[model samples]
Target chain A: MDRVTGHGADRSSGRRPVLTAARVAGLVGAAAYAGLLASTRPFTVEADVVTAVALVAAASAVVVRLAGDRSVPDGIGWRPYLPWLVMAAAVVAWELACFFGGARPSHPTLSSIYDIVARSEAAKAAVVLAWVGLGWALVRT
Target chain B: MTWRSVTFVVWTVLGLATLVVVALAMAGRGRIARPSALLFPVSTHPVVRVLVVLGWMWVGWHFFAR
Candidate 1:
């Protein structure tokens, strides 16, 4: 007998997908990170660091899960969505930091390290390429 | 060595290690695609998650928010 799974997989096994506590925690954490980023403005340095760490940790969790390790508790297979979540979190953080954190008038924010590099065309290109690489890696399932 | 020097050296080593890993991943020349099994404990442990989140908040408060 074939059993249809939410993943659209037909398997003979009768096991149904279950949502574990860990999975719920990860999803909630990702969502909270996104919400915080969206509503917060001129984030403090603390906010920047927390958001960065969360983004990195979530990304790592997703990577570990996708690399075929059963370590991360499966929850609706949310690992695939992690990269997008990370990217969104990062973009929001960056924009908020840049716009609100930047010094009054023309000075860039202290966290705007990219602005320093952007002064050099080659460095700017490198940074842009790095962002592209990051996007590519994150989007890969 | 001075504390600053020590910090510089440590950062340099870490930077080089990161570059090497990135290079390997790009080249598709190694089996480093998957994180080592050692990460399992950190990833799966509940206490660790709480501690990490707490630590993150602490760092943000102390260092970022003046």
Candidate 2:
């Protein structure tokens, strides 16, 4: 059954359907990240890994769900996910490189050298949580 | 009681009280799709609503933990 709104399309009125759970979830995720762009807070290295899990979960909801939309925002299916996934990867790598490069020069506790290592490990754990959450979203009563 | 003891008890009661109030508020709403009622039926939502409210609590805790 279509998960968006339980009721399928009505044949008579023919209005465009509302967003599905996946689509709305995806849209909301994108919007949330888009909002993050305006944040003035200094970016820390841990953010990348945390966002990776969040990014995947959000993107997956949009891509997999979006109900019948082959594409949205004028981009065809799966296209929108590419940039986010790539950006997340690049951020992770960037953080790692920065951490390794700065480890020698920075304060032991204040710098991101420690953050990079911590983030990567934490990101792994977050991925597990995302998986569980996604599965719960799927199986939720 | 020590300040630590009092503090713990107060916060615990506050947390549980919050939960109870939310539950009561939810119950007062006849059902989802009923905006006529004062209380919004949050439990009927697709789990995300509950999670979102809990997320707000988490944010509150995260910010207030210090």
Candidate 3:
């Protein structure tokens, strides 16, 4: 017996069947932007400029989503999401504790660890690309 | 272990826990809610969806910008 569960019943999986020309072009453009941002030094004006561009992209996703159907969804229940809420709360709590306790080398915040890992140009570019990709996903969702 | 080491360990554990949840969800485990299930309804609310993306923006700035 086949059981069809979850949303989008017509679709077997959420993934796109084929990458369109527009998507390929977008990926190429994002990669170029990531490389350009990777070359900039952190804490410099150049890095700030790159960050601003990324933020704008994220903001654009918000605009695009809002421009669509504005109807309130049915049954936005908290029960199903309790586990995720708890996990998010735990992470936030620990981050706050570490932050207030002093972000020493031994007691590093997540961002502090990210800073160390993102020091490499390749890693930095990858992170920027990931952030851009996440924004793109947000737009699509 | 020192308090600092403990802090680092706790953070690592939290990160790992998140990864585990994502992996389980992706594997289509019946016990776990998929990422789409967790986030799709979030996009339904106009205000909440905007706030979520704004939070994402803040994280990028915090890590990558001055």
Candidate 4:
């Protein structure tokens, strides 16, 4: 558990000031990419292009992870993951229930609520960027 | 009132509860592990890692494209 969780280490220790030129350029580039994606209509060629990029990136991540260090600690049972599993299950259950209940305005599923937020291009771009960043984080693990 | 409204309320509560749990974990509260702490080890397994990344890709496509 300690090996996996770093139970004794300072959790806040990793963060550092990374405001270099390359970091700034990377942030700006991501924002520009997200903005460009958001400008296109959904299901269109432009949209599909960005989506393809994400797909390719994720596929590469999987391949890299598989080809790299594959070691994992033994005997790390399911108990440690129970909290996340339960939370995810609860969220998904309600999403399904709401969808089955007709997904009307009165009973908005999470996606429906997100639809309203994503109506704003800026918000849509932010979410797109966040989704990409989250994928990278998960893949690096 | 209606079942729809009640369902919406429950969904809101679930969202809020999840947020609370994440907040607690971020704060380093006892018995609540950080999400990174949990996810890092799980992702070490190649199959689960692939599934998770694929799920993430699906989400991006579902919301942003199709």
lDDT of 4 by residue, B18-58 (tens): 88878876665335666667666646577777788778888
Kindly list the per-residue Cα lDDT of model 2 for residues A102-125, writing each as its tens digit.
443332221333234324544433
Best by DockQ: 4
What DockQ does each prediction reach against the true complex?
0.05, 0.02, 0.50, 0.54
Model 2, total clashes: 1
Residues A1-141, model 4: lDDT tens digits: 354443455666676777988788878977887898888778798898888887897798679768876576455656545677789899888788778867368678777887888889999899888887787678776
Q: Model 3: which residue pairs collide?
A: none
- Local distance difference test values of all predictions, in order: 0.42, 0.38, 0.74, 0.76
Question: What is the Cα-based lDDT of residue B32 in candidate 2?
Answer: 17
**Residue lDDT tens for model 2, B1-66:** 653344335435544654554454345332211112211222233344345444533432222121
Off by over 4 Å in 3: A1-16, B27-31
Tens digits of per-residue lDDT for model 3 on B1-66? 887779878987887998877776566544456666766655667777787788778878887776
Chain B of candidate 1 vs. true chain B, TM: 0.47
Instruction: Identify the candidate with maximal lDDT.
Output: 4
Query: In lDDT terms, how accurate is model 3?
Result: 0.74
Q: Can you write out model 1's per-residue Cα lDDT over B1-66, one digit (the tens) per residue?
A: 653344335435545655665454344422333222112333444555445444444433332232
Error of 2 at A49 (Å): 4.1
Docking class of 1: incorrect
Candidate 2 - CAPRI tier? Answer: incorrect
Q: Which pairs clash in model 2?
A: A4-A20
A-chain TM-score in candidate 2?
Answer: 0.24
